[model samples]
Target: MLPTEKDAGSASMSQVSTSTERANQADVAYGRLKQLILDGTLPAGAQMLEQEAATRLEMSRTPVREAMVRLRQEGMVEIRPRHGMRVLPISASDMAEIYAVLTALEGTAAELVAQRGITPRQLAQLRGAVADMQTALERSDLKAWAAADEQFHLHLVRLSGNSRLIQMVGQLWDQAHRARMLTLQLRPTPSNSVKEHADLVDAIAAGDGPRARKVHEDHRRRAGTMLVDLLDRLGLNQL
Candidate 1:
């Protein structure tokens, strides 16, 4: 029997709706699982089967499987044929490597922003982040300080107007998040770091590309060295 055009159209729409729903579900699963890992709820070296992940996420195996594939690609997890996924831990060596790449990428981002010139609104946003960091430190709230610090760097990268740089730096930041949070209290007070951020902001506002690059790169290199040294001294081979 030949189907009517209406019937074919309806069937096609239904297929499209179903596909969209599945993709949304996969995205939800991916975000939830990644957050769990980042917050240490899942913890490093944790392993679970496909069914377990589905059950925990309150979804079907299909979407959970799709999410696992993404995490695997991001170096956040490893999927075994039948073992589901294992959360990969970051070691001190991994920190060194991640930071090295971050230094170069973020330095270029700063230079670009300075060379191109930023708007007053954009400059205010960076200043606001620095102010927040200062307030957080004054209150002895390390967590809040960390959040503001992340925002400052995030704004720096975004101001570069380079999509690739933003994406790459974002991924590396996520990879280093757990380790940095874990070692926050162990590191020295961040007074100098805050000042450095302010200095970088000044360079950007003044359109001093070379100074901005040098300030940002030097800050990043020092931070990376300190973090790696802290991790090694504490014998945290795997974070």
Candidate 2:
């Protein structure tokens, strides 16, 4: 059937509006689900029911299902035959692998930033995130601290100005976030992390790439060791 001009314009607008609405819904679902997972509201190895999530988000199951699929692709969830969709459990070895990749990526990013020089606006944003992290630490807010920590790493990745690098590092960062939340929940003290992050910012501000790289690597390595130690204490070191 051929459509007249009026019909064509209306149809196009309808399609665009529908797409825009779907995109917004998906973002909302993904953000909520991701926050739930990171904040431990959705515990590791817990079942993820799409209908339940949809109900919670006040949306249809379709967007929730799509978000779960995205999370699965991000290594945040696993779909098992009998278990259905479940949050992946934290593992010491998995933490090691994630940090190893992150160390390389972030070190490279530091070098890039030093060579290219980050803009003042980017630096300001990074400092703002760090300040927020300090406030979270002072208030003993685990969720806020973790969120700020993620933003800090994300800012550095964006500074690298490499789309592929940003994407790869983001995936690793998400995995690391899960492990970090587990560790932070167990410990709940932010002294070590606070100092490490402060030193990182200092190095970056000084334009010391080598120092920044070393500091970044040390931070990841220390966190990885702590997670492994915690797992061992819990008698779950095999992970």
Q: What lDDT tens digits, residue by residue, belong to model 2 across residues 1-239?
A: 89999999999999999988987898889889988887778878788677777888999977777788888999888866444478887677777788778888888887677667777898888888889898998898888988898888888889988999999998887777766666677863767887787787778888888888888888877776777778777776432
Clashing pairs for predicted structure model 1, backbone only: none
lDDT of 1 by residue, 97-178 (tens): 9999999999999999999999999999999999999999999999999999999999999999999999999889989999
What is the lDDT, from 0 to 100, of the residue 182 in candidate 1? Answer: 86
What lDDT is reached at residue 108 by model 2? 85
Q: Over 4 Å off in model 2, which ranges?
A: 80-84, 124-148, 185-195, 237-239
The candidate 1 region of ten consecutive residues with least summed lDDT is: 185-194
Query: Per-model C-alpha lDDT, please?
Result: 0.95, 0.80
What is residue 41's positional error in candidate 1, in angstroms?
Answer: 0.8
TM-score of 1: 0.97
Q: Tally clashing residue pairs in candidate 2.
A: 0
Candidate 2 residue 33 C-alpha distance from true site, Å: 1.7
